[model samples]
Structure formats: structure tokens, C-alpha cells
Target: MILALAIPAILIKEPWGPLVLALGMLLVASFLVWTLLRRQSRGFPQPYEASGLLEVVLATSREWLWTIGPDGRFTFSGPISRELIGYDPSELLGQHYSRVMECEDLAEAIRNRAKREKPDSSWSGLVTACRHRDGRRILVEVSGRPILDGQGQVRGFEGTTRALDVPSAHDVASEETRAGVEAMLISRTLLTAFQPIRALNNGNVIGAEALTRFLSADDRGISPEAWFVGAASVGLGVELEMLALEAALSAAASLPEDLYVAVNLSPKACLDDRVPALLQGSSIPLERIVLELTEHHEVTDYGPLGKALAQLRREGLRIAIDDAGAGFSSMRHIVELRPDLIKLDRKVITGINADAGLRALGAAMVAFAADIGASLVAEGIETEAELDAVRQLSMNAGQGYLLGRPTVAREEWKLWSVPVHLKRPASGPTTGQHKRP
Candidate 1:
């Protein structure tokens, strides 16, 4: 049975393939041992007896095996817990899972739990942080499945966790990066750049998207994306995102009031209470702000996200689903959120002027956006031909090098206050006008 399971897992190309295989073997070993003990006693094994069998199976394993009761408190913790997270098996009993996790990761787990509609569903390969008894943070991968009773009801959850190996050099560098991100947050040093979004038809600047840029004396040429990723690894992702949002909104005070400002935010960041608070406290009216849902992370559940956006929408904020046509998640966001604006990903617009398939997709998106009462914005319109193609497709707005590039200079932002018509000849006059959003 173990070989049968191992054969299938060996074919899995995922990064967690080994972890899956190891967990499967451990679970099978536990069952076999439990059966032998039951046979010897001529009765069903008691809870403690089953737990003893689990410990025997886990003794030789490197991974930490754990079981949680219906109340989500640890009911059984394998001996490996001591080596894995610096906790004795007895010490973790009756303690909530959050007791060993970072606060942000704990909140995320809670949010995910709230989103689970089916109690019997399983989850695997979740990379998250765990707290060591020495107060150090350790990165671990967790996989678990529901523990069901005889009546087929969920009784608890059983899982295995193993720390991800990090090279000593990489670990040192990560610590440096974490410190840099921390210093950045403390000093509020993130710089905000603005990229103009123009009316595709008339070539008038209608809005600007806020982008984050980083510069520091000890900069290692790391990109802004890398900085955010590093911040997330250390459990500071939300704080960094919120800091960027605050900086962008603060800079928006200098831009033309009529032009809305779009800020990119992952769904996780949007759920943070500080998000609404920051927006509400901004000098710019909520109506002039567009929250662009970025594709940085996949939204596991749309229920809470929809509710959060709805409340913000009610407060006069408009939602825009970014990277439309890029993947299924973006399309799902469009359908579920019913966003006010749908931004066409650059992939669909890059060669759209020459590709029939791309043009057809652009047209379909335009019609789809209209049917859903949303405006379409073509992203990454780099050439006159691409701009003309999107214009022909009747995309409501566009942003790219052909229209405008992201800039941090206040002088350039001031230039946008007075819309400058593009020198390129119009592909006939277009009638599309910029709405409030």
C-alpha cells in the first residue's frame, strides 16, 4: 500500500511532492500499527493507545505530526514537535494552533478557515511561518486533512509539518533583507510613482496608477517586487503594502483632483482593517480612489473579499480588476466582483494589432465589460499601432509608454494636470469619454 501511494506521488511535479510522499507513508504506518495493537487487544484501540502508535510511527520521521480537536486545540503532538518547533509534545497539547504561528499568518489562517464551506475538504503545501520557543521565526510547509468520525462528520484535523531548508548564505541574506524592509517601514522611505491612464479615444489623461519604488543607501539593486516578497517572507507583507498605500494616497494630494488615483493591492491587504482606515483618512475623497485588485496572490475565497469591497464601494470607492485575460483568477474576479473597471493585461494587447486572435479577445472583452456595466482599460499600449488597435476595439481607456510612463517627479505629475494631446494622428475621432471612475 505504501509503494502504491508512493508511485503516484513520485509522478507529481509539484515542489511539495516529497513532503506528500513522506506524509502518506507516515499515515499508512500509523494505521498499520494501530491495527496490530487492536488485534492483540481484541478490541478497538483507545485514544491514548492510538496516540502511542502515532508516536512510534513519528519517532523515526523528521516531520512533525499533529492532530487538533474540534475546538482547534492540539489534541496530540508528535515527538518531532520538539525538534521541529522547539516544543515538547506535552507542551503543545490543548494549545491553539495560533500559539505557534506568527500573528499575520494566524490571521490569514483564520480568514481561510472562515472561508471554508466544507469541513471535510483537505489542504496541502501551505507555506507559512512558525514561531520557535526561542522566539526565532522558522519557515515551514504544512499539509493536513480532515479527521472524520464514524458518522462521516469532521471530528478534527490531522497534519504534518516540516521546515523548509534554507542555505546558510541565503538565510544570512534574508535576514539582511528583513532588516532593510523593517528600516524602510520605520522611516517611511517608500517612494510613490504615478503612471497615467488616458482616455483611449481623445488621448486625455483621466487617471493615474500608483506604483511603489525603493531606493536606499545600502541598496543591493533589489527590485520593488523583491522587496515586497522579502517583506512577506518575514511576515511584514501587509504592513509594507499599507505603507505603500499611505504613501501613494499622500502623493495623490498633489495630482489633479478630477483624475482618479488607482492603487494596486492584493486581496489579503484589502481585508486588513487598516486599509479602509487609511483610505478614509486620506485628503483625497474616496470617490477619487480606485482600488486595483492585483494578481500578486490568488484569492482562495471571494465571500469575505466581496463583502469587504462592497463596504468600500458603498463608501464611494470604485474597484478595478487588474490583469484581465491574464488567467482564470482575474476572470473570476471580474465575474464575482463586478468591478467598475476591467484592465486588459499586456499579454492580450502586446501584438494585438497584428494578431487576429488577440484582436478577437480584445473585442470580446470590450463586449463582456459593457454587458457587465464596466469600462475596459487596455494596459501596456506601447506602440501607435497597438493604441490604434485598442482604440478600434473601443477600449475605454489605456496606459503605456505610448500614452504615459510611470514617473515619481512632481513636475511630470503637474504636466498631467493640463492634458497634452498625443502628436500621433488620430485613428479617426473616437467618442469615448472618461467617466468619474
Candidate 2:
């Protein structure tokens, strides 16, 4: 309209044609430029916001991440991988896994990885040692899944690793307890409580596992120290072993025919000369019992424990590495004892399912249990998810809150189903015995 008006004006000698044309061109050009700039100048995502594009990368960069190609060659790694394992990109990109693993543990891990390499179980766990730059060992718990290519060939793996330290309940008890436990070799104050161990496969009560519970006769509200510490103080750990043995055997006679009770054994019991003799006439069959080795903070005296375990094995008593995850790194025990069972730590099982990483590790331990011809039992199955995780890991035995709570001894003990006591008053004691009123 302006151009037409200007043209008319110009024809009428208004001299407005050129000015209007130039102004109109300028306006059109400016609009086009503004539109182009608006399209091209959109703001980028900020890294600080969670949903921002940079945040995704930043998050992954902080986690231990890696990618593997076919033939089990490394292909990619998150920036944090180096921080986690102290490996350079060149060291990992094409290296085979065995080079980094502890020599003894590597073979079995390789076998497990190989089995998982072609299966649906792309994610499996492997507990191995990684050598630090200083030649020190960094025990790493690893879980990995095979990274298949577009063609789905036997590619490498991606996994995560963290250093591990699993402490036992005993570890946290107190310095006083440790000093006292090591101080004694006999005790008349020893007592025991039994907790029923149920079989997950059959839903039948398999047997009760005995735990040491000590009572304070003077009534200090059942001092925890008196039992373990008293046993150590009296130097009657061996005698206490016999007390538990008799109780376990007596309890066994009335239980289900197939039931086999497990009793906790102190390191002292392994060295006790009479342990083998005491079981000779017991009602419970030697082979039916599992002596769970406890009181093992370290393996400084492994020679004695090893001999005792071997002797027990020879006597037909099954061996179980109690608190396998908590006590010292039990590879030596596992290899040397070749225990019939590996009772996993609750710490390791805690939050296993929610954390995919823990699930992988539990799976790996389960596999190790399988390879050794031992059954796997996950301790502290406090949640359905934890149970489900164990189930997914193909665990056969699990004991924790989800199964049942610990109980104490009484008539109709089956109903009582008490946790094993370390020391209780002798049943026929004259007076003022270990039992507190």
C-alpha cells in the first residue's frame, strides 16, 4: 500500500518512489535477518542442570565405565575408569583381562567370563586382584556384561570395580572382647542358642545352626562380653566346644531324620585334642554336622586351623567357612579348606539388587561357590529384592530376616527355635551355674 501510494505520489511529482522502495527493501531484509538469527542462535543446555545434555556425560564420566569389542578387547572407557583402577587408556584398550588379574584367581574368572561370554548372562561378577603401580594388590570386585557388536559376535566386556573390605560382627564387638577371647583357653560359663536353618528348595526346616550365646549368672542384663570373653578368659574354648557338641548332638536326636545341625567352632576347637574323641559316641552322626569356623579375624594360625579342619573333614564332619566375606581374605582358606559351604556375608548382600554392581559381585561369588563344589548361602536376605537377587544369582541357600528370626532354647525347642547360645547354665547344674535367673 505504501509503495503504491508512493508510486502515485511520485507520478504526481512527489519524488517518493526511490525512498519508499529502499525503505521497503530494508524492512524485508531486516525481517529475514531477524528470523534467521532466531533460528540459529538457540541457547545450549547448561551442565549444571540434571536434564541438561552435558549432565549426562558428566554423570557417566564420574562412574567406572568401559566397553569391550569382540575377542574380549577393550574398546572404550569412562574417564573415571582410570581413576578407579589406575590404568591408562593405552593399557586397557586392547589388553586381555588376565594380565591384570591375580594369577591364581584369574583362571576361574576366565572360565566364568567365557561361559558368560556366549550366554544371556552378559553381566557376571569376578573377584580378582589388580596390581597397583607400586606392585601392591588392590582387590577389586568386578561385574561385567559382554559387549556385542552389531553383528553380535563374541565381543569384549564392560564392567565396574571397587575395592572391598567386609568386616564381621566380631570385628566391631570391641577391643576388650578380642583381647579377652585370646586370653582364655577354658570355660565353664559357655552356653549356646540355636537358629533354625530352613531349606529354600523344599521349604522344610533342614536343621538348626548353633550360635554361641553366653549368659551372665549374676544378672547384668545378659552381658555380651561374658560369653565370648569368658570363654577366652577361662581358657576353656575347647571345653565350651564340647558343651556345644553335646547340646547339638542331644538336639539332633529329636529333630527330623535328615536334619543336620551346624555348630560354630572357635579357632581353639580346631586345635583341641579331644574334639575328635567327643564326637565318636555322639548321637549325631559325624558326617551330618557342619562345623562353622568362627573367631577367625586373621589367618596367622592357619596351620593349626587348617589341620583341624582337615581332621574334621576326614572324620566326616562337613566344613563351612563361617562369615566367609568378613574374616580375612579367605582365598587361602577356600583353597586349603575346600569347605563344603561358603556362608556369604550380609554386608555383601546388602542392597545387592538395587545396585546392579553388587548383584554382579554376588553372582560372581555364587559362581565361585559352584566351581568349588560348595553350596552358596547368602546371609542377611532382609528384603524381597535381595532374595530375588540371590535367586537370580542361582543361589541355593539363603538365610536372613526374610526367612526367619533367631530364637532361644526351651521345651518344644522346635517352637522356640532359639538362636544358638554361646554358654547357658548346665542343665543339671547344682546351683549358681551359668544360667541367669
Candidate 3:
């Protein structure tokens, strides 16, 4: 419209018409150029805003954005990965995802997501473990989405990693606890002590439960339970359990071949593929190693866990349910797992000799074990009466302070030829002590 009007004004040559036409033509041309530029600019990335928001995000964000091929090889690793894992960006390329992501539970979660996710879907909110380039382990929250090709095949994976935030008093406490546990693990400051599990019939030492004690920097001892809880909080439960198991196996190497060694593991740790790998490398015979499945946490899904345990059992490993009768759920655990041994909890065995109800409960456990073809091991037999009580109940095994405290001396274990207190009458004074040579 402006051009049609401008042409008439230019042709008439009216004084102001030429000037008006000139300005009109100029305005029309400028408008056309502006429109074309806008269309062209749409094909390119948007110009960065003056606020520099993208630059601010790239500079300040903590998440490590990453990409990996369908083959699980890293294709790109963000700067945060290099900073947190102590690896150069180039070092991560071509490395298998599992090389950096080693935790069993996290791997299982990833595998499950891959199996269940729809094409082009994303999974997130998973807190997982990743190995630092320095050989340390750190907990991170990971979120990932699958990248798909035109034909709908998964071509690659994209993800972000963020450091797990310690956001509450409980989390802060957990972080402190994890730091303490990590320090102990790094320093190898934990001491493995063996508490003898004796046959109640003759008090003959048939096996021993391996216990771990963290010797703090101040030379004070921290209980195994506390250390283990801390480890679980930090996603280091399996690793620390492996360490304790390794220590137990090392100590077992020097003991008499006839005496089996019982090592405790959480159900989750028991299912970890790393457990079997660790076992394979150890010289300890499968039959001589009893993996006592302690209720570190409740067993939620027993099918998969039972299958894993069954595999180990097929390899000649024995499974024992520790701390039975501490709660009713423990009995359910025994029934579901069908372990070879049921350890009566200290609470159940502590005063059974005096408390008739306790004695009856102990007897019931013995019968339950018998019905299931399992042996009952009574723990926390702290008195002669407790010993006599469990003996009457036909307990298959017993372990307690009264029998023997956790001993560290290898000579003492080697010289354990017979039951140290077996000769004493069950009615004898509780002081019938077993002296370690």
C-alpha cells in the first residue's frame, strides 16, 4: 500500500510528495528487511539475553550433565564430573558407565528402569553410588532420560548427577557418621574379633561369628552395629561388609579347617553381585563359610533375594538368620529365607533359665527350627543357668560373653582344642571361665 501511494507521489512531483514518497519507500524497505531478518534469525539459536542467564547456569550449576552411548560408554562428561570424580573430561570418554557407577543397588535400579521405561521416557530421583577417580566412593542423586533414534531404537542416554545434599539434622548426623566410617575404612583401623559359637551339648566350639570393631583415632572403640548403620546410610554398606568379610576370611585361613567361620551380611549386601565375586577370590572353602544374614534392614522383596541366596547355597554356602525371636517378623524371615540356622536373639536367650515364658519361647524356636530342618543357635548365654536352660531346650549351638568374648589372638584360636568350660557342671558357679592361651 505504501509503495502504490509513493509511486503516484513521485510521478506527480508535487513539492512535499517526492520527500514523503522517499521516506515512505525507505520505511517500507526497512520493514521488509526487519521481517526477513526475524524469519532468518528463527533458524539460528536465540541470541543470549543481556541477563546472561545461560552463562550463569553453566557457571553456577553443580549437576554434572553427561551422555553415554547405547553400549554404555561415556560419550560426554561435564566439567562437574571432572571436578567431583577427579577425572579429566577425556578420561571418561569411552569408559563404561559401570566403571564410574559401581554400587550394586544403584546398578540394579538403573537396570530395572531400563527394563520398565517406555521408549523415550525418563527416569529420575535415584540416589546412587559413583566411584571417584581417587578410588573413593561418593553418593549422588542421578536422573536420566533415554535418547532415541528416528526408528525408535535407544541411541544413547543423557543424565545429570548432583551431590547428595545433607539437608537436615538427621542428614548432617548421617554425613558425620559416614565420614567417620569412611575414615575407618580408608585407614583400615577396624579390628576383627571372633566370638566363639559353641555347641550347647558339650560346649565344643563349632564356629565363631566374626565381629568388627572400629578403633577410633582417639583409641576408643566403636561398636560394629553403629559403624554398619553409618555405612548403610552412606551407600557403603556392601563395601564395608565386603571389608569385614574379607577380614574374617583372612582370619579363618589360619584356623582349623573343621571349624566353620560365620560372617554376617545384610540381605541387600548378600544379594550384591560383588559378594559372590569377593567369595570367588577368597581361599575359604564354601562349605566352611556360613553367611549369617542379619536383619540390617527389612527384606522387602524375598523372591529375588531368595534366588540369590539359593545360588550361594548351591555353591555350598550356609545361610543363617541372626537375631531370631527379637521380633515376630524375624520368624517370618526364617520361614521365607529357609535358612540353615536360626540364631536366638540375646533378648530371647538372656534370662530364659529363670523366665518360664522365655524358656517356652526358646523351646518353641527349637521346635520351629526342627520342623524346618534348621539348627538353633542360642546367643547371649551369660550365665550357667542360661547355659543349662538352652541345653535343656536342645539348642544346637550357643554363643555368649559367658562362653568367650571376642578374641583377637591367633594363638588362642589355634589352641582351642576342646571346650574350655565344658568340664564344669552346668550348675557350677557362673565363673567357670574359659581362659585363652
Candidate 4:
């Protein structure tokens, strides 16, 4: 009525405003019709005006909005659920949130919920699998926060889930990789190869590094590193690493008791609670085990890792920083971790016999290791000249093609039970003749 009264007054003041007046009236009429339809559809009481608006917004959104009670049962599921997962909101109410989650994603969702239990805690962009009403799985990106009561305790959770449209090629490859890794884990088919780490001075085997090998027909052409990278891409990196660790530790049981078995592990895997349990349960004694930190991945924060390593060390297990001098991160790891051993990377050991800079770096590492009371091991000693160079530097131990190749044969492993003298090259120049760059 107010608009009706003001329209004539404006038209009388400006006679040429009929088109403007008609357009304003049409807009007002359309808005009234929309408001009326919304009110009738929602049937909300006038007192719930704001809630009515929220309902309209949620009904139109593509993302599914959800709320669950403290007990994890669905309290409310938006109308979008019907379009998103083929389940009507009414069908989802009172069901557990797990009802819509894929089996593999349930544990991850539970972990995220635990985080939300803390005050003001929220999580976003957690991509997980959701189950559809017809047994199909949908990939979704989820974001949520805990709902708090007046007393600041978590009352429930509210969240939004949007379906992800991954490119078909990438999605197919990821699914294949995930399935492959899962099969490998289930069948326990990973093979352990032991590469001897020898004493450079006496040419006697002191320890063997456990290397994981995938021997399944499907995995024949894929390198171990590629397999691990594929597993990581599909959110199964930790699972695969743990499986490899278990396999390596299990194989270590057959090796000589006097020899320490060095097992490679990523920092993230070390932080897993299962690691300590795995180590404790191993038949091999703690003192006979060495945990080598693979340098391919960077350690974001060393405090927790340091604490974890400290706990393991106190249990009599030694730690080695693998691939030291490969990069600045590796150097940082040595300074921060203060490992019992520092293994020189293949990059640093290759051609050290002739490169003055490489020799100087090797000499500096030898000095550094002695100063820190850590044993130095040269890796990838493929040629006799490389072996001569590392031996000349007085490296405590070395492992390479010249020493011994990684072998899965039990007979070859038994050969290390006795002292074996490794022949040194007679032609290489001695360390005394090498000039400092």
C-alpha cells in the first residue's frame, strides 16, 4: 500500500515516468509472489522468519548440509541429500553418519570428529568417500565444525559435503593404485631384500639394510619408490610403509644376531603409534635394530619426531640419518637429530675418487662424524675406486655394489655369518696424494 501511494505522487511530479513505474511494480509483484510461494512451501510460523530464510537458502544450495548429535546420529540432513546421495533427508534422519560414509573412510571421519571435540576446532577440505543409497561411492570434500552449547561443551556437529568431480583418467588411475596397494597389503606379498653394510676397515659385515621389493606380477615393472609414491597419492602411504616395515622387521629375525638391521622409515611413519608396538613385538632385539630415516621427505617439525626417536633410542635402538649431504634438509636432520650414524648419499659418494670438491666434502663429513661420535657409512660404492676413496676417508661402514648387492636369498645371508675379506683396488691413488680444493 505504501508503494502504491508513493507511485502516483512520483508519476504526477514526473509525467514521463510510466515505464519506470511499471518496471518497479513488476519487480515488487514478482518479489511478493516469490515470498508467498516460499512461505506456503515451508509452512513456517511468523516467529521462525529467519529459519524460513535459512531453509530456502539450504534447499537451493548444491552442497549437502548436515547436522549430527553428540552421539553421531544424524539430527538433520538437508533436502540436497536426495540429489547428492539418492537418499531423502527423511530417510537419513536418526541414522548414524557412517550410514552414508564408505567403509574405508569411516575411520578417517572418526579421527576428524575427535579433532572437532576440542573447543572451537574445525576441519576443511578433507576429501573422503561417501556411499550412495544404491551402493555406489561418491568422492566428496567435507568441511565442518563442532556446535557448542552455552557451557562451551560440544553439543553436536554441523557440516557441508560437496561431491568432487575428479577427471576420469586421473580418477581411474588413482582407483587402480588404491586397489593395488590394498591387495598387496591384504596378501602380505612384499619381499624383503637385505643389503650388507660392511665395516670399511675389516671388510666384515656389521649390518644389513632391509629394502622392500614388490614381486607381485602386477607390480613387476614398477619400482619400489614408484609404488610408494602411488600409495601416497591415494592416501595409503602410511599403510604401505607400515606393511614394508613389518616385512623388514620380520625378515630381520633370520639374519645374524650380531648384525644390526637398518630399516628405512619416513618421519610420518615413525610418529605412528604402531611403530613402537612393531619394534617391541619384533623377535629381533632392540639393540640389533637400527631405524634409518629416509631423506627423500622433509621433516616439517622435529620436536615430536625427536621425542619419538628419543623414546626409541632409550629402548636401545640406534638411529641413522640416511642420505646425509643429499640436500640442506639432510644436513639439518643430522644437526637436529644427532643420529648414531650418518649415511653419505650416493650423490656425494659417486666419483669422489677424482673430484677434489667431493673428496673435501667426504673428508669434512668424516671429521664431522668423528666430532659428533657418529659412524659414517658411504652408500653406492659401485666401483673399486669409490670403495678405495671411502675406505681412505676412514668411513666406519659402507654399502654398495662393490660391498654386496641386496639379496633375498637366505643362503647368501648365511655367508655373512663368517668374516669375508673384500678385495681393494691396488691402482687407486691414496688419500695422502689427493689435494684439497
Candidate 5:
């Protein structure tokens, strides 16, 4: 009845796991509902202990052990219970287990467990609410096992309970990072920088990708990756992405009207209703904005996203899949979403001049984009040889340090014409090279 699991890290980092857990929880609920309707044989009350299966789930130090006697009163509550519920094991003795549980349907859970067949009596993944000493509701995941005597008679119940809201070490670090993001958002300390996307045909800057950067009060620049990842960890991913888009559009207002501006957003944000609303209010025309979907998280549902994007397309906004050819989901993203453009990942473009396999992959991308009527943009082109290799493949557009580093000051956009400084020629002539293949 209204169990919510808000594992921010899991939601952002491992979306599939939560989806599986949600399915499992639903199945468990269905079984319980069936058992209640059938009123299956109610076994005698029994004692419970930590069985091997439960030991594995409770192996983590964060888990707390709990046991209930035949009378449905907690006989043994672990030490962590004190920190969690403000009640020590001694204090909780002889207290009804339901006293701490906030869920009204827990009685149903207990009733369903009573009808379990002997020697096979165990129920897990019962998500419910628990009350803290301060009366705040805390979500808890519980599993219970029925303890039996040598005669196969029920004795009591033993099980493990863990708080779903507990934060891991990684989560703690993420919280600190989120604090930084909050400060940046509140103080408006963030800025949008433009990285030129050049037309390989004439080497003139065709457009630019909007990149977000945070100015650290300590004078150390924060990486854009950290800012975005931290924002996702704190449930502000869509907000932060939208903020960057708005900033980029505002800054790009000074840019030449002929050039389009590209902005990166996660797939989750693309499905948000606010996306179209944000676009409509921006000074940039829909035709001049390219919304590049980042591959930071895998998209499980494409149907609704496709429809939302279809609406955007009708409004003249273009879609581009960012970091293509970097992972298994690239092809799936291309086929399902059918983006207006595809941006080759930096890894694929880095050493294409000498790597035969990369060269072949680049050619395939060019051919595929042409077949699909979509433009292909090569990213992170930091060498003359890399540029030359892409030009030979008849690539559409490119962006990297070779073209120009991202700059917040619009006047510095002219740096696109300067030759990129290279440590060494990329296995080819630096200046004079062969014409396009």
C-alpha cells in the first residue's frame, strides 16, 4: 500500500536494478493478496532464527537483526535498533512488533505469513513503513523466517530488517558533491561555454555545443562531469540540465543567427513535460537549437520518449544522440530514437588516423548517417591527422580542442581558425596533407 523506495544513487547509476526490484515487489504483493483471499492453512506460531538465506542478505554491516516470539512481540531486537528507532533491545522486549511499523497493511502481511506451509515458511521483500522515535516515517525492507522445532511444530519467527534510506560511503561523498551543486545553483556561479562544431567541408565554424562549467569559490575549477553527476545524485538532474540549456541559449543569443547551438541533456529529461515549455520561452528559435541526448543512463522506455520527441521535432527542434559508438546502447539509441544527428564519441575519433579499425568504424558511421539522412559530428578532434582522417571519410561536422576550447566569452569564438597545438603529428603530415580521399 504506498511503499516508496528513493535510492537516489541506484536511480541514477543503476536504473535496471530498481526496475527489477519493483517487479519483484509487485509479484510478492500479488502472492500475498492471493494467500489472504484463500485463507490457506494457518500454521501454529513458531520461533524464527537467521537461516543461511537470511545471513546472506544481512551480511552487510548496515543490516539489523530482529526476532518475534509466538505472541507476536519482539523478543530480540539488534543493537542498531536503538540508533534507528530510539529503542534498545532491552527496551523493546515484550513490545508488539507492529508498534514500530507504520504500515496499516502489515497486519495483512502477518496474516498471509501465518498460512505458509510448514518447513517452507518464509517471506521476503515485504516493503513497509517504520516509525522512528521522532515519529517520522522511515521505509524499511523486511524478510521473515519461521522457526520450527524437531517435531515440525512452529516455535517463533526470526528475520532481518534494513532501512532503505541508509546512505553508503559513496552516497555520503555524493551528498557532499551535491552540497557544492546546491551552492552553485543558488549563487548562480555556473556559466556556459561554447565549443565550436566546424564544417569539415570549408573548415568554417558551422555551430557550437554548449558546455557547462562551475567556478569554484576556492579557485579550483570543477569538472562539468562532477557537477552533472552530483546533481543527478541529489535528484536535481533534470533541473540542472535545464539550467544549462537556458544559460547556453541566453549566451548563444549574441552568436550569429545563422549558427545553431547544441546542448546536452539526459534521456530522462527529454521525456519531461517542462522541456517543451522551456524551449518555447527561450530566445533561441526551435530550429536553431539541437538537443543532444547524453548516454549517461540507459533508456528503458522509448515509446513515450519517441512521442515527446516527435512533438519537439514538429516544433522544429532537432535531436542528436551524444557519445555514439561508445557503448552497447549506441546502436539501440540510433535505431529507436532515430536522432537528427549522431555525435561520435571522443574515443572513436582520438586515434582514427592510424587505427585501421577506428577508420573503418568512422566510415561506417558516415555511411549509416547518410543512409538515415542524419548528420554525423565527430567529437574531440585534437589533431590535424584526426581532422584529415575524418575529412577523408566525408564527415559532416566536428568539434574538439583542435577546433577550439569551450569559452564563455562570445568574442573568443574566432579561435576556431587557429591550428591546434599537437605534441607530435598523428602519424601523418601536420600541415600539408593529401586532399579528401
Candidate 6:
């Protein structure tokens, strides 16, 4: 579900063999997953032995495998199950897959899934339960490939599952979790909150970034990761994303003409035609709405991404690369795509004041953006010192705690509208307090 935005690394210009294509997809997807798991551990075990029963079904057969049951139980498992659960395939059986899961989470998810709702999950990866060998329940990553029975009617589900190895839902009963989860389950119930992105020098509210808040009955807040993961689990990720997009566009319609609204695009939804079409109808100028490529996803195909962006650019829509330094392709990608805005990630800003190498890198990035005729926006500008350093970097703009905090239902969005250098106009040009959102 977290990977709902993940795009396959390879693109298909023209198809030759369906079987070959499927195999290719499997290998690429499996490798990506394996990397995520193994890179964190010394050496993870494979799902099942090549000669094991699960091996025959998962390896020889194309049907995806899962060691889970409908009640979110991993009472049984297959070889591939080990790949997902981080346990021996034989260890899991009769374990309440939801045992390790937060109770409230299981209930809510089950309720949603059983509703058989059509979610915006066009790009959501499937999830399943796989029993761990040690009789422990683990959440497994899986791909749902229907296991057809002799009758050809739907009987049971079969998919690959991977354990995130995450501990119990962080405070599932907490009000925040409840609110976030409920909003995601019922997309429209959530309000798309907007916070202004101001220019440090002039205090002008140049843009607004939409943030989500749930109007849940319980009033608990949900994390973006949890919301996305739950939505992906029930196959609603794309729909949720689109719903957010709609809300964002609607919210932006009330802002100034020059104020661009930046909306996040899930990896899977990147190439979706609906995105361009929706923007085309927006009341604001298309060029003013920045479609940020979130670091949460990887752009598997630079060619397609480039081509897609080129078409958008042709339509006068500008682009911005979010979390600039967080990916293997961040800086390289900025050059490749040549976006209008390059957002410097917070990682580089964390200790730049104390680290010369980091400061130089940050300075270089600002210079690179200038050289490419793109504006550089530094994120995480929390400290007065950071603001001074960033200002010295001479980047086009910056945003962080040092400037202001993100406010959604502010009494007056204009309160923090001052441009950089004028943020604390009454305070003798001293900077304002900056805090992380």
C-alpha cells in the first residue's frame, strides 16, 4: 500500500508476450521488495526452499502465494511466505495474523474490505497475511493474482505477502490514528486543508500546499503513511489521491491568481491522464499549479516520466521536484527533467551550519538550480541560523520552522504572508520562529 505510487522500472512500448511481460514484472517487483528487506538486514531468508511445497506452487506456478486467511490470519504459509514474513515458511500456521496488528486497525480494515468497495487503487499494490514460522503474526507484502478454481468462480485469494516488521500500530486507539483512518476510508469526509507558502523577502503568500485532515467520528488524526497504507490495502489509493486532487483544486480556486497550489502525485498516478485533464479544467492558471513528484515513490522510467512532463510543459504547466536530495536520482533527476522548482530536502539542511561539506553541497545545489534557470526552495528552514545560512546561499526562496509553521484553519492565512527578510517586519528584521510540521 505504501508503494501504491511505485511505477514499474520498465515501460512497455509494445507488447510481445504476456507471459514474458508478467515474468518481467514479477522479477522487477520481487527484486525491489527483496532490496527493501535485505538491505536492512544482514541476509534474509528466501520464502521457501526450492524443493519445498511452497516452492512448487510459488516458483513453478504463476499463482501468487500468501500464508494468510480472510480474517487477517496467517495460520498457514508457503515458501514465498518466508520472503514476506521474515520467518520460516513452516513456522506459521494457526496464528491470528492480526495478533501483532492493532485490534482497532484490523476491525476497521476488515470492515472496509468486506464492504467490497471500489477504491482509487488502480496503482495500489496488494497486501496479504503470511504466517511466520515462529507462530508469530506478521504483515506480509503481496500481489493479488486470483487463484482460479475448477469452477472458474472466485473462491479464495492468493497473493504474495511481506511483513513490514513494523511493531503494533503506533497507538491505533489514539485519536489521531482514528481520525486519519476514518478519513481515508471515507475519502470525502476529510477536509483538504491548505497552508500558504510565503516568500521570505516580501512576505507574499506565493502558494498554498494542501494538507489532509480527517473529519472522523472519533476525531483521531491519521498519519499520511498510515492513510496511504490502509487505502492501498483495500485498493483505494488512486481514488483517495484523486479525491485529494479535487479538493486541492477546489481549495486553490479561492486563492490569488499567481499563487500556485502544489499537489503531491502518487507514483502510480503520475502518468494517469486524469491528472492532466483535471488540471486543464482548474480555475487557476495551469502553469500556477505545481505537480510535485514526491520522494515517496521512484520514477522507474525516466523516458516516460520525461515524455509525460514534456507534454504537461507544452500545456504551460510547470513542474517541481519534491525532496530533492532524498533519492538516488534526485539531483540527477532535476537535471534530467529540468523542472521549474527544485525543493532541497531537509536532510541536507539538518546540520549544514556545522558541516562545511554539507553547506557546500547545499550551496552547489542552489547554484545548479540557478544555472538551470530554475528556482531553488529550501525546505526545513527552522532555526534562525538556518535561515541566515539559507539566505546566504542566495537561493530563490526557502520554507521551514524558522520562517513559520503550517497552519490549516488559520483565522487569517495572510498572517504569515510576508516574504523572506520581512517575516518579522515589526521585530527589526529579525526572523520568525520556524518549526517542523
| Top lDDT hit | 4
Query: How far in Å is the alpha carbon of 424 misplaced in model 4?
Result: 5.8
User: What are the lDDT figures for the candidates, one per model?
Assistant: 0.76, 0.56, 0.70, 0.77, 0.69, 0.57
Q: Residue by residue across 1-437, what tens digits does model 6's lDDT show?
A: 23322332233334644555566677778878988877655554443444476446666543324544443345355665445445454544533333223322333333344345454222123233333333233443334433346987534344443444343345443444345545655647666656566565655667777765444443222234346555554455677778778877877666656677888876566677788778888787777888887634445677877777687788788888877765555666686788899888765665455557768988889778888989888776656666666666666677654555545554555444444445332322233222212
C-alpha lDDT of candidate 2 relative to the true structure: 0.56
Indicate which candidate wins on TM-score. 4
- Misplaced by over 4 Å in model 5 are 1-174, 218-221, 414-437
**Cα TM-score of candidate 4:** 0.59
Ranking by lDDT: 4, 1, 3, 5, 6, 2
Query: Which tens-of-lDDT digit does each residue in 1-437 have in candidate 4?
Result: 57764875588567667776777777778888999988876885665788888988897899999998875667899988998888899977765564565222433343444444543367666556665664444667688888999999988889998986633436786798789989998998878989999998779999999988766655423446556656776888889999999999998888988899999888888889999999989999899999998745457889999998787799899999987776667778899889999999765776677678889999999999999999999986766777888887788899876778788998889889799886764555733211101
Number of residue pairs clashing in candidate 2, backbone atoms closer than 3 angstroms, sequence gap of 3 or more or interchain? 33
How far is 305's C-alpha from truth in model 2 (Å)?
Answer: 3.3
Clashes of each: 0, 33, 0, 0, 9, 41
How many Å off is the CA of 103 in candidate 6? 26
Q: What's the true lDDT of residue 423 in model 3?
A: 44
Full ranking by TM-score? 4, 1, 3, 5, 6, 2
Worst 10 residues of 5 by lDDT: 428-437
lDDT of candidate model 1 versus the reference: 0.76
Pick out the ten consecutive residues of candidate 6 with the lowest summed lDDT: 428-437
lDDT (tens digit, per residue) of candidate 1 on 235-350: 78888999999999999999988899999898889899888889999999999999998753356899999888787799999999987776677888888899999998765776
- Which 10-residue span in candidate 4 carries the lowest summed lDDT? 428-437
For model 5, name the residue pairs that clash. Answer: 46-154, 46-155, 46-156, 47-155, 47-156, 47-157, 48-156, 48-157, 48-158
